[model samples]
Target: MTVGPAEARRLSWAQVRARRLAWHGLAEPLKGAGPADVASAMAGTHAQMMSAAELGIALRMDGATRADVREAVWGEHSLIKTFGPRGTVHLLPARELPMWVGALSALPRPSSPHADGVRMAPEQSEQVIAAVGDALRDAELTIDELTEEVVARTGPWAGDLVMPAFQGMWPRWRQSMHEAGIRGLLCFGAGRGRKVTYTSPRRFLPGFAAEEPEAALRGVVRSYLRAYGPSTPQRFAHWLNAPATWASELFASLEAELERVEVEGVDAPQWLAPDASASAFAVPRPRDVAADVPRGVRLLPYFDVYAYRVGNQPPALLYPGRASERVLRGNFQVLLVDGEVAGLWHQRRSGRRIEVTVEPLAPLSRARRSALDDQVARVGEILEARPTLTIGEVTVGGHA
Candidate 1:
């Protein structure tokens, strides 16, 4: 059906939750899938904080653990660490790096924040990215080592580059690090002592060849739609960290493979992939039992892709006056119940035990409260630590 903006199917909040939960592999804990599968399923886990990424992947699986993630990256070579959406570190399946590389590389680089005369120009950034790849071929180096090598190869100007950031001087050349990752030249490696390390993606997948930018980006858009669609071009733009005009242009090219859908109470028309099922838009009836709890209750860490992907939606629909602008803007970890944000959670290691505190936005049923306990138990298993749960009073728009 040709659903124009006016005739779009209004997707109720429950329907939205159901569709997202299913796509997220949270409808049921995924069985027998490795960490690589977890990364691939959600496009990629948010790895800006590596622990959160590990937990994010483990939460979607029946029995995965941090060791599983370590083995995948450090031993099995099934996953590669690289910068992804929003220029943050992410764990991506090694096999899919080329497409990610090509698509991300195609995005226009943001303007340098340094003074006009101090900023490295696009051409200079490219030179540094190439140098980084060359320097790390089959080897791992810390940031200082990589920086020195980049200067040696790219010229003195690379080291001279600096910019003001947060009222402090920032290494301007470090901006190209993201570019290096997108170009399949750089990734995070096991650190040495307390020092961070970098390596080439070739260390994990030798001789990886990238797809042409256009074709690869088409695949990316399709993947995004598969995992998080019934969405808009503007949302896609945000997800990609691309300019809206560019995202709209790219999305328009895929119209033949997309269809418009109503997202219930949302006024704007949302689009989904051509193969999306009609059931995804059905008005969901409230359940008497904890239907979404047994299989989907989760303690998703901060900046989890699921929350970030859906953050732009109307607040009332998910957690009603619970999400603050700062919480949304800063990306906080949350307690997800029945495919919606039910509360916020925090954890700290106190000796061998993980002390967990939860603050819900509203009162939950007895079944839901029990399910939350189960979720805590699952987290304890993953962390290999005894867990202590403290239920805090429901507080709206408070930081965890």
Candidate 2:
């Protein structure tokens, strides 16, 4: 069954879910895939659909390690460059870092009045760089330790001024690192004692070097489409939090490598892999038998990419008026069936036991409920003796 580009682009929402789940190994993070690889694969699979945090949680990484993956992928420590979209830091993958940075930088400067009284001049940046170099010369230091050293060497002024200075020169620092092919944020370490520590930049692995901006952008764009293709340019633009004009430019730059198609009933054009033939349309079907349901429950961390991939479509479909409100305030771990979000789940741990609370967005037929139960059991098995399904809640329209 040869699938044309148009049909492939016009896949049902279910098909899209199946395709993405298959790419991520849905029920589990693929064996042998580390945090970096998991992140890279998610970005590649969903294209622009997955966020840095989502990828991190899928791989079950902590905050410190998440930062390390971000640095390794995007070659930067912070997500602040140009202020468009949400004006928040996003963990950009390494291969696509340049384009995202460039696109964001092209936007107008935000008028938020540059945080009062926090300014770092070029000379200050140099001093900080020197301090960082010295600290990382032999071994990496936790952010606290590194900050302390910078403050000590540069004086009290450096104490308050270093972070601001780092933020100010972040763009330049990132550009230099990207150009030299030096990747930052390699590994994460435990904090002093049991406290959580911030991820630090490191020269962990080799093989990354700088390249022409256009070349880098092209590679990034291609990778995005490979993982998250069959998506509209608007969705891509929204995902990147970039302007449509910049998105168009990037899309044009990647024209030679991508194929554009219009889904059968949809009016807008979508982009997909050039070689994604009809066979790509053969998405895995939803299981009908209870016994055939895939085992394993995924404890998706807060801000998983699955929700972000469709650019807020999930909220619109599931919660309607409450999408924005719930997403902003709640930390929801959705239950997956095959690939679709079958329900919402919450976890509460007391002592050594972790309780999983599931609330289905839609009324589950008996078969679907049984499938979800199997998934919950699998999750219990993975957690061994530590996590247990203490409560199972199935709600329809807010009551379980």
Candidate 3:
């Protein structure tokens, strides 16, 4: 039987953060590490905004640049852009596509929100999914070309441009793109001029095939726990944008693999597992282990994966300071100090110069202020811009 939280020993949040920081590879930028390594470590680096996502990888990799990231995606074909956790776009390692494909395919999807006229029936949806794969076999096609292929295969109804998108409508068949992506039938291909293209995963991975759902789920769950564990079912559910009940059932099923513990001040229990890198319940004195935990000032781009955490955990437990909230989301660039959200920052670029504004939510020591200077310079290196720092209230409405 799994030990309950009450029976488990308590650890200070500082100790837990130390372990988490090590797991996140935040001690220093990794030398000679490629984009895929960082993506796998992050479980798949968030790529809703490719610029910021590239920065996320560069932050952990030594002397890396944006060109390296593009090369991984479009040149070396080692990373593929596809639907990731919470249905957002991410750059996933091509080698791990089997598990990512299988695990995402197994997740429950809500029925299409479009009205019946714009929505494809279950049978039609299946047909479109199949057609999408067949149309893209060993071929790359833009949205227009793919639509023509799908319409030809599934009939004119599938081509109806009725589903509302950002500023216009998308074809009825486009609704299945998410399923087509995770089903291992489709992935992003090189752009044709300015238009985005789609191609089969087989184009990059010759022997590509999704693993069994059960096995793949286990693999991904282990990866997730390794990077963000000591996490609760609810928090895991939230991170995956999955149903709380589904997460609860998945965790229950993995009881044998997980060990539970209660971090002081956190109302719910967290779970972690043994891995090659560290002990399961071994949060010790700072002197007892390698002191590679997160420290000093770091400027993280918007939508960085480290932003994941529950909102209710006491702010002081993570960010040392006077702060109101912990869950930083959307366009706000993160000013992370010592493994937590210390403030919010934003940047604007002109020619070769970038203007950075940082708002600290807590007090900073003199040494930390000096460190911020170095951090800003590093940001400049990643962005290939000269950075000018302004320490003041970021007046933007959302800190974007």
Candidate 4:
């Protein structure tokens, strides 16, 4: 087999898992770091679901409670929730919003020929973006309220651009909200009753200025590699939701900072920080799985960044063999033991009682079963509910 320039090293599956755990801050949870530290380590948490984001951050920090996270976000305002990498909701460190704003604002505006004549003109899009920032500057407003303010500022043309969407007729111009958030001009705010609200990131984090675009984007690339490297440009592109050509070009400019090395099981060259050593991949595996192989157990939450961001691999690899696509679709919400999907677990609360159910992909060893019990106790502690355990056969995509 011809090993090309891309195929520089071979990394065993164990080596891959070892490096992943270390990079993810899981091999050893961080000490004395706050929620922002955890966010910075992973670039950002997958935060479409607020609970998942909170759990993801807590898992990475020692002694961080739900209240601590809430304080950082709503009280101290150290973390900001907004649209981030890949145009998705994420929890980012408030201090870093300027850099994110600069980098994300540099991406080419999205256009869709498939739209039924409802797209915003580039100039109109910019106007809407500015309007969103201005409207939310004084106070948090619900989406409807924000839209009305935008319409009042940008006139009827902005309000008239509605298009069909899965959620039904959405104002085409409002798509710029994602852009506004990425540009550090807007973010999610505390709710009013059941109504979600938006506010300017500067409402709490003041005086942040966007860094020069190219330098800001270069920093983003560096952070991604720091958290998930020994990877290729293709993987970086996939994670960033950018064109492969764009990522490759960026990587080319970063040649002096990255060192290419061969991995045991991979066919392509992987790049890492020049100061990083291959010894990270040679760490001893846990004794339990070290013998029979593939050890370490964790009950990760829905959209945990760990499961969502594996480089180049299908997300299904997290689950066991022959697991149904339905199950794999829900895999991000499942339990993982040894880096592979081991089971499904869910929690429900009633009064002071929280019911947690587990359904393993297959029968587990005594050690793994004990590990599952420990996770159940930990879940109960995090939720502050007296938890009862239920174990059985779980049908994928069904209520736990």
Cα RMSD for candidates in order: 4.7, 8.7, 3.7, 4.6
lDDT of 2 by residue, 1-400 (tens): 3345445434554454444554445644445544444544445222121242533433432222333444544454223111122343334444434444444434433233234444445566556656555555456456556667666766566555322343353222221112111223222333357542333333422343334556655655554565565566667777655567777877766666776644333556667654223221222222211124334344444456343355323433423333334333454555544544445666555765757777654566778666566655555443332554533552323211
Instruction: Please report, as a residue range, the 10-residue window in candidate 1 with the lowest summed lDDT.
Output: 281-290
Report the lDDT tens digits of candidate 3 across residue range 269-376: 777765636432222322232234457577878777244443225555664544435334345777777777788888889999999999888778999999898888
Rank list by lDDT: 3, 1, 4, 2
lDDT of each: 0.73, 0.45, 0.77, 0.71
Model 3 clash pairs?
none
Considering every candidate listed, which one attains the maximal TM-score?
3
Residue by residue across 359-384, what tens digits does model 1's lDDT show? 77778789888888998998888887
TM-score of 2: 0.62
Q: After superposing candidate 4, which stretches have Cα over 4 Å from the reference? A: 1-10, 165-167, 274-294, 305-308, 312-320, 323-326, 396-400
lDDT of 4 by residue, 1-400 (tens): 3334665444555555566665565655666678887787678777788877777777766656666777888888888889988899988888777888888878765455435567777788889988998888888999889889999989887776476668777766676778888888889999899899999877787777888998888777776766666678989877767788888998888877766656554666777653223331222222222123345667677777343345624444544475545356553466667766676777778987988777777788999889788777766666666888888755445322
Lowest-lDDT window of 10 residues in candidate 2?
174-183
Say what the RMSD of model 4 is.
Answer: 4.6
